[model samples]
Target: MEQAFSGRRVLVVDDNADAAELVGEVMSLHGHDVVVAHGGKAALAAAATFLPDVVFLDIGMPDMDGYEVACALRRDPSFDTARIVALTAWGDLASRARAVACGFDGHLVKPAMLDSLINEAALAR
Candidate 1:
């Protein structure tokens, strides 16, 4: 049987307020501590204080794209164990490759399945 996972601190970043909130709500429902940021800058600020175990980032934000945010997080030793995932509308091959190059541990297309989100959080454990 599969083992059960405990709650984790999750950060969701997106330019769309609704999208960020929706993801945050879903994660919270699954027993994760969730924080929603409306842009990359906000995400960085939140990460500094929240120290999330998992972060879901949107690639197309106007100010500081997801790649930049991921790179910044990766540079910080405090975030070495954090799981950063790309959660964006851009699911093309090049985009996926870029995500890896920028330090994303996983990639999920926008409107990702709820189960997938929960599973990603669980994997951070």
Candidate 2:
């Protein structure tokens, strides 16, 4: 299938270098303009420049958690409408509920298939 994520601006926030790269590569392959950040601080800085349509945030980060990042992003009027999807290893219903409460537009478990990632990104758009 032709990727549904084409031409979309996506921000990938993950502390794991390999994971970050993998996510960026996946989105790029699907024709998204992907920008990556190693932490929440960097992610916040990148947002201004990236102007991403959607943010894929890993919940477990050392410096700053995804919840903080999502909340901060939501506070900004410009990013208020931007989609914030929690990209984490947590797949349980409780985790999903927590993510929703933390302001995530959606929840995606780790090691997501390429099609699933693209589909999620499409929904965010």
Candidate 3:
């Protein structure tokens, strides 16, 4: 049976604008209310109003970077239950450790598979 995931608030943050938008589009197709942010700063700003349930964060942004963004979000009381997932090309031990240190709830390697992406996103719903 095809599982239907109800709409959940999702934020896709990446310096690669097209990648972010693509992921956001896929999330939307799978019944998520998705928002795309092109940088860490913009992601933070969007989170303020969007109050996303899951943040698919790219770790290599220019200004703030995803770890810093995750930390900032974790500091905010409104995001206590929010899932911060690292969406990065880097899957090294150091990178994973840093994500954990920054309070990320999970990690998904970039060029995300559609099925895995949907499953991970479903966690928020």
Q: Which residue runs does candidate 2 get wrong by more than 4 Å?
A: none
lDDT (10s digit) by residue, model 2, range 1-125:
67644888999999998998998898888888999999999999999888889898998898999989988888888787688888889798987887888789988898877767777788753
Candidate that would win on lDDT: 1
Tens digit per residue, CA lDDT, model 3, 3-27: 4655889999999989999999988
Give candidate 2's error at residue 103 in angstroms. 1.2
The order of the candidates by TM-score, greatest first, is: 1, 3, 2
For model 2, where is the 10-residue window of minimal lDDT? 116-125
Cα RMSD for candidates in order? 2.0, 1.5, 1.5
* Model 1: per-residue Cα lDDT over 16-63, one tens digit each: 999999999988877788999999999999999999999999999999
Better of 2 and 3 by TM-score: 3
**Superposing every Cα of model 1 onto the true structure, what RMSD results?**
2.0
Give the CA lDDT, 0 to 100, for residue 36 in model 3. Answer: 94
- Please, what is the TM-score per model? 0.94, 0.91, 0.94
